[model samples]
Target: MAPSDYPRAAIVTGADQGIGRATAIALARAGFDVGFTWHDSEAGAANTAAAITALGRRTASSWLDTTDLPSCAPVIEKLAANLGSLGVFVNNVGIGLNSSVVDTSYSDWQRILDTNLNGAFLCLQAAAKLLIAGGSGGRIVVVTSIHAHQPRFGFGAYCASKFGLDGLTKTLAVELSEHGITVNAVAPGEIATHLGPDETRHPHDIPRPGIPLGHAGTADEIAGVINFLASPAASYVTGASWEVDGGMAQMGAQASSHVANNDWRQATRKGTSNGD
Candidate 1:
């Protein structure tokens, strides 16, 4: 295909693996020339680029430390230059912290916020400038988590960052709608990626009760939601967060399952029932 014949262009942060990789490939398959960023995994980034190119879409990969605001400008500039235009931006780069607030050091908190929240803002700003300059309007998708809506035991920092990102998505949607740019967030839950909890699980292992769907999600499933948002069909959609979490967000009934651990339970007619 001629260079000009390529559909639109997209940049996916953290595309070295997991949801970011899947999003990049999905966009490529949807006719977008894809660019992606990796932090410390050049091999993984190369693999993602190769996959996109295999789909007959142009691909560009760069090393990006999302925590460093100064490092973002060049990555965006280089990708936009190579892709010829910027039509979509996916804020998928983030680090998860599995620590309690009490145990999380100040540096750890800052690192999480810097990478997950501040970095996303910087990226959106850079991409928005290009999209506004191009005057074509564009899609901005932030890959949040189910924790954005609910807190978890060991994901304090992660949940906070995701919540912040969701707020950013809504605010940006309202602000950028006039310019025709759409801002939205995809909150995924229990996606079975290398970085996911299910990565080391046995195939026969039972699904977590927290997920009402009875199974973990896959990266491609989340990517499908993102792809739809990036498409023209979503032109009327903005300021929304699609919970691509397979009903996890709606499983308010799961709270009853936690009663199994309660020690204060009444005795049944025949015997003492400990609930569980």
Candidate 2:
């Protein structure tokens, strides 16, 4: 069973693949009954579910397209209902499109914002309301990119959306504190996932001479931090952004993800998160 201090139920958005897939399985191993959403890949979602089930954890999934603002809350509610209740919510659904300031079309800009910013707002609001209604302390983790803090020339739309999320994380942290819900953000650097231009590549497939880690990170590396932030140990950690990059942030165009423990990858009984 999940620790009594926090709800064992968790919901992750865009969980069919990439970092989302890693986090869902991690939470399940940590004793969470996970609820996840898949946009385009039923096969990927099934693969994730198989892993969760193997851990002897209950899981539920739904189709979520963050660009549909009105659909966000209902989908969250449905997932929470399936899991019985919610304790931890991970808002990991977002899209990144490369467009320069001059090359950015109005339509593309809207598409990026609608998914990354506007859609995120609706989903986080819904999750927060559910946690508040439960009257028990909870956790909310947002998956942003390094763009949330630093700017890249070609990813204007993505950077703007992520920067907006950084503010949103702080705002929600303050607003939800009274309800015992801690909110934080995770900013990741180059990772091998389908999200980039070269889709479906392995972690070491792309070499990064600039990244201090010497290679791209895997989804599990970022998932490690997500798992920690949702644990009782991280109750006092809120309204902050943890970068999951491998020493990338040290450079002018770097990122951060600071979970130093490999133990986080495994499941074990955790202590009470006092909802500080």
Best candidate per lDDT, number? Answer: 2
14-35: candidate 2 lDDT, tens digit per residue: 8888889999999999999999
Cα lDDT tens digits for candidate 1, 1-276: 121321399999888887898899999999999988887577888899899989999988888887787888678878988999998998888778667788889998998888888888888889888878887788899988888998877677778989999999999999888878889999987766653364576422647665667777878898999999998888888999998877877876756665466432322112110000
- What is each predicted model's overall lDDT from 0 to 1? 0.80, 0.84
User: What TM-score do all the candidates reach, one by one?
Assistant: 0.87, 0.87
At residue 65, candidate 1 shows an lDDT of 86
* Model 1 worst lDDT run, 10 consecutive residues: 267-276
lDDT of 1 at 58: 94
- Deviation in Å, model 2, residue 148 alpha carbon: 0.5
